[model samples]
Target: MEITFKANKNINQEQLLKLYNDVEWYAYTNDMPQLQQALLQSLDVISAWDQEVLVGLIRVVGDGLTIVYVQDILVLNAYQNRGIASQLMEQMMTKYTHVRQKVLLTEEAPDVRHFYEKNDFESCDKGSLVAFAKFG
Candidate 1:
């Protein structure tokens, strides 16, 4: 399958909403686009399309000259294990290699950790490094 990659700021909102809904790790109740308007405005987003169908996407939220946090790296359920997410992450990391750090927060799961480790992430030591999270 041919995959087209681009930094498409004006991605189809409907497709994105559907894709977000399909994510296995999170549930949503509010309007995604409204919630994501700030992110869409500030983040560097890359999308993968195969023959006009969006297959995967990745977003980097950062200061552009400093640390970058990887967010919303999602691939459709039907497209899992196809290396699309890896390619997207490689692209994202390459884009921010000059930054102080490229970071991501994963759920507490071995498989998720393995996935991030494959992409060059290490488990953050809470004793040495303080981490923060915002929960509702």
Candidate 2:
């Protein structure tokens, strides 16, 4: 499968909803307008497409200099295990190599941890850093 990557915020609501829903991310799919607005205002967005089908996406939000927070990285269930997410991460990392800090929060899972670790991200617990988050 030839997957093409694009760095742009021109994705339609249907594509966003389908991609998120495929990954069971109902939290984002629940509010279409909010999600769309969030992506539109993101620092950067990289998407993978199989021809015309949206298969994967990775988006970050930050000031683009001191810090960058990877707000979301997801791939369609059928498209997992194919290195699409890794490619997205590689592109994002390359784009922000000058940034001092790169941060992301994800569910606590062994596979998830492995994926991030493979991508060169260290867990806060393993280092001298600590992370805190409060959800509204």
The digit string of per-residue lDDT tens for model 1 on 48-136 reads 98888888888878787878888678888788888999999999888888888777876786478778889988778634666778978
Error of 1 at 77 (Å): 0.7
Instruction: Residues 12-103, candidate 2: write the lDDT tens digits.
Output: 89999999999899999999999999999999999999999999999999999999999999999999999999999999999999999999
Q: List the residue pairs that clash in candidate 1.
A: none
lDDT of every model, 2 decimals: 0.78, 0.96
- How well does each candidate superpose onto the true structure, as a TM-score? 0.86, 0.98
Best lDDT among the predictions, by candidate number: 2
Q: Candidate 1: what lDDT? A: 0.78
